[model samples]
Target: MSFWDDRYSRDEYVFGEAPNAFLAAQSHLLPKSGKALAIADGEGRNGVWLAEQGLDVLSLDASPVGLEKAKKLAAKRRVKLSTKLLDISDYDWPAERFDVVAGIFFQFAGPDLRDTIFAGMIETLKPGGLLILQGYGPRQLEYKTGGPGILENLYTEALLAEKFSALEIFHLGDRDGEVAEGSAHVGKSHLVDLVGRKAG
Candidate 1:
């Protein structure tokens, strides 16, 4: 089993069954009905939430175990969720295919890999589509609430601005706050959030 597979084998959702607070807060920005992509969506929390919001959601993760749990969660929630097993390193991100792309707490990638994934997130967006992302900021190393321990795996305002520069960034900021997602992320954390839109 892969790292994520092992991590998700637990009886409980490590990150909890609720959507990320930041993503939930951005609900108003989502289209009433459209395609959405949830990256690294473990146990389908965010993807399921997106489906509940009337969007055709595709949840992508590298762990089969996690994907299975995601499907089960979707059924329990009575919402449709499509899941795919994909490694972001080699993913062929479809161009202009989704109305929204969300990457919440996906800070496991290092600099090089993150660059590829970030670019793909931008590429997959439909014109005027929204790109939402929230991740641990550099200071997260101090909080150690959740996310990778490596500093390079954490996000910074400048890094995000440069990475998703193709889009018209409307909201971008970093701050310390309490994050209660699940057992994994429950405490004060340094976080950065970005919301941008592709040119129509």
Candidate 2:
């Protein structure tokens, strides 16, 4: 078992069963119904919430243990969630395949893979599709509440602006606040949230 598998083998959902705060706050902006992709979604929180809102959602993560728990969470919520086990580095990202793509606190190891992942995310969306993402900010290292220990994986407004320049940015900013996401992420943290639409 891997590190995440070991962590998820325990009885609790590390990030709670509710959707991410940023995603929840921006839910009104999502289409009423469409195909949605949740990247690195563990325990089905965000993906399942999208399903509940009537979107056909796919929850992709690298951890089988976590995905299995996600299945149970979907069942408990009486929603259908499609799941796929994938590592973004090798994921065969298809072109223009989705109406919405969400990546909440999905950390990347470095710039190389991060670039590919960012490119893939843009490629995966149809023109005018929505993209919502959130991640730890550079200052997160000072807090250590949750997120990558490496500064390279952290985010900044400039990074998002540059990376997703092809998209029409709707919201891109950083904030410091308390994140009460179960036992794993509970404390004040700094994070960046990004929202945009692919230009037609």
Compare the candidates by TM-score and give the number of the best one: 1
**Top model by lDDT, which number?**
1
lDDT of 1 by residue, 1-200 (tens): 88899999998998999999999999899999999999999899999999999999999999999999999999999999999998878789999999999999888888889999999999999999999999998788888999898988888899989998899999999999999877899899999999999999
Question: Per-residue lDDT for 50 in model 1?
Answer: 97
Q: What is the C-alpha lDDT of each candidate?
A: 0.93, 0.89
Report the CA-based lDDT of candidate 1 relative to the real structure.
Answer: 0.93
lDDT of 2 by residue, 1-200 (tens): 88888989989898999999889888788889889999889788999998988899999999999999999999999999999998868787789888899988878558788888889899999888999999999889999999978999889999999999999998998899899998878898998889999987
> Which stretches of candidate 2 lie above 4 Å from their native place?
none
Error of 2 at 31 (Å): 1.0
Candidates' TM-scores?
0.98, 0.97
